[model samples]
Target: MHRDTGRDVVVPEGLLRIEDCLDATGGIALPPGVTLISLIERNIANVGDTVAYRYLDFSGPTGGHAVEMTWNALGVRMRAIGAHVQRHAARGDRVAVLAPQGLEYVAGFFAAVKAGMIAVPLFAPELPGHAERLDVALRDARPAAVLTTSAARQAVDDFLAAMSTADRPAVIVIDDIPDTAAHDFDPVNIDVDDVSHLQYTGGATRAPVGVEITHRAVGTNLLQMILSIDLLDRNTHGVSWLPLYHDMGLSMIGFPAVYGGHSTLMSPTAFVRRPSRWIEALSAGSRTGRVVTAAPNFAYEWTAARGVPADGSGIDLRNVVMIIGSEPVSIDAIRSFNAAFAPFNLPRTAFKPSYGLAEATLFVSTIAPDAEAGVVHLDRQGLTDGRATPVPADHPQAVAHVSCGHVARSQWCVIVDENGDELQDGGVGEIWLQGDNIGRGYWGRPEETETTFHGRLGRTSTSGSHAAGAEADRTWLRTGDLGFYLDGELYVTGRIADQVCVDGRCHYPQDIEATVADASPIVRRGYVAAFTVDGDARVVVVAERAAGTARVDRAAAIEAIKAAVMRHHTIAVADVRVVPAGAIPRTTSGKLARRACRADYLRGTFG
Candidate 1:
């Protein structure tokens, strides 16, 4: 039975089942009034000699060797880094970490947290002008110090040399620091409410914002994840290739592994260039225990097409729980992956589609372990007609997307219209969430913080008194996502901001792009993009044809796409610009960054 508690759907029976699991497992109860750093410190005391991190130092592009760091060794390294920072930087200072993924990055992060400093992590220099971008972030954040590796030292030095002396943070090389510095200082007491990190949101200056997440908020979110997903069992180990800078990568995988005393394998670029390595790691790691890892929706499609072998020998996917998130959840991607990996004994139920954001400290809802990955097909016309009508799989123009599942224990989610009124089931609306896991607010910008974090819906309190005004007492986060709840599960449609309105009708760009993708051989499925141009919407497609392929004969491809889109949505495409393969902009986690692409298009760089 489901009970609507205004903010979330309560499953009382599911809560009982989780409690039973917790009782049987005898898991660590999170002691009150403790910081995230304390959890790591306590785990080190108990699991001193156990392996905490496994790293591969790729000397060159050809070959590399592996190294392991025990819990004791990692703790010692963290303390040393922390001590160095404490001596050089002030408490509550922000420290920027710019380096490739490795053991050093992990150590630098924890050390900052231990020193009562906020760690600001950014991607390594990859794209052109990345150095300039890093410099901007460093200057804006005014970090006390910048942590980098020996290899990155020269690059960082060069970047700093270009900036004024007063604008640069103190650059510190991890390899140059002495190990003896670890014992020089005593551990300081940390408050759970202290800011742990300042996570920057993706966007240009007009929309730039950073969410200030506190230790208590992160810890509470992790606890909710543990309770909701049964992650406290010793048999479950965490593995991730998601970049540590992102909130999902940090809080969901990194913090959980550290605090839960479970071993984790982290590599930033490993899964992106070669997804098979992730599966290989998962299979090999699962011999000791079950492996839990996560990636965005595209990774599943990419890996399914290239990673798994046909015969399925030497691959065991049965014990792997692949949590897919960080972007729009595609039912096609999930089903395709399941079918592709089924020969390797991959369980259909192992694909977990979840919903979350940085404001919630990462996870807000997750699919139940026993439940099959959820998918719902809606009638396209009805969806555009201001209502959601579930259609059969065989129906024409049926749009299928995966559900993000039930809400987290410490959080509540709701679907509300633009007026902040609750929408009935199957009505697409903005996703609003409120709970302890909600982050403190965006850092530095009070106006943006108030607008983003403190908005409301008028509702009678449990005490039976009506609260008037938008900011009465309850606060709900405006997720800016369009989705609906079906049978108690939340299925995200697309971003509300991404929707293009024309002639009194709302058109989802993703849907138009998907239709275009189906009609053209050159256009890769899920590679077509649709965005607004001036006042009208335009379609930009990136096809997978050979680099030197002739474009003169592709008129039919364009015509087919135009016809399909017009037939489906009655919206004429303003223009169709087809570029070479790999032209689409994607996030580090493999999510298609449509906004980034639009920015690139405006700059005339997307060809």
Candidate 2:
């Protein structure tokens, strides 16, 4: 089944049966001696003068002034940077990047890759502890040097000043670096299996874990993405507002564009302060050809609520394939976006919900291009009871969730029981995957590497019991995601670590949020967070009450929500906080940062 909106096309059936969708090769192909850096070199050699990256400076509101870089120019700049780095850092040394998204950021990243240095990209500081997080990352990574914009130099300086000389890594201001002069250096000889990058997990202080991505792994994943999604052929232009620190922003969008030799437009803050700018960028790309872009679920929701400006002229979105990922997939957000932009030629299927992680080098299962948006309606009661029982969409017990589609080409995924046994179709379990695309392991943490990567057990078949023999021979990456397969399509339910047990039943935070939103129009649907406080599970609903109405009486609202939840699912709500709109914290891609929010709440940062 598919949906058509004038110029937009969606193929729902294309993603519904992912296992059956591929040929016998299973999408895994052994590339003949290729690495990620090699791919970039090839692109530069072929399209050396072709424009690669274009950026809009956020300082200008109108966004007419921008900077552009061609492949040849980028290669030259990268070589100079690599030469400078080779003088200071050796192979396998860590080089950190702490700049906003732009040409310089990409150049720094690629230069690190060429120098055979592990690239560590950090988020631009937003709060007081931002520097502390960077400090922790610096200490953990033990980088040879740090790269930052001139604007961020002071912060880096202050951070280094507080540290002992022996503890601090050398800091280099990106803008301060002069052009290469007289020094000619060869790029480091990098092994395909060597570590390419270290993507830091959000929890910096909590045993800083960085997913160790390899050049070969990332390169194969990019090839799979290009082949499976047909990104090389279909997408003539790419635009992204996702932050560079994120896997989706870096590998999925950035690497693919470079690998495919396509022109890419980027903005660091455009999607954050004003999401409509992303839509505007897409419309701008439409004038040339179809533009493929990506964001999390909330981005779509935000753009839908705040309508894109018409300007007395129509902006067609039919050619846009807005990949919704980097967080939990929200079906309501997808439906709302489609309805909101129907008149703008936004096809229902254009919202391609995908699933991936940094350990997988970003690209994993993606809804096939032009595939009808895939959905799974399951018994909410059964889902909470640790069983996945399909329910009719209209059934009172039904909960609608979208599928992340199928595994990307060259990768294999399985739903496994707690004992490491592969579950049958429609059975919920932790998502485990194995492929050449899988990252090596966590950087500098052998114990964590063993726990998350090497020690994971593999399944012999889709519906087989856990084989103890194969566990030692094969390496599987535990995704920490709780999901199930229906008709070969993967439907993510919740994070394994995010599940809270309430009244002997496991309640997913997402399920709680959806139910609370349904109970009260005042409750912000996706902003709700359910977690445990002390010994008891608590549901905290943060919402924006209607304007001009009586201020939300917290005591009454809490009781009302408690009663509503009890009546519907026999679950009790511990608290409900109604705040001004936009109080909830979200990731750059627009997914709720639940852990960050919980920390903020504990620190009294949120009212």
TM-score of each prediction: 0.89, 0.88
Tens digit of per-residue lDDT, candidate 1, span 190-217:
7878898877665421243567888877
Q: How does candidate 2 score on lDDT?
A: 0.69
> Candidate 1: worst 10 consecutive residues by lDDT?
7-16
C-alpha local distance difference test of each model: 0.70, 0.69
Q: Quick one: best lDDT, which candidate?
A: 1
Q: Identify the runs in model 1 with alpha carbons over 4 angstroms from their true place.
A: 1-30, 57-64, 127-136, 204-208, 252-260, 310-313, 459-472, 537-552
For candidate 2, give the lDDT of residue 361: 80
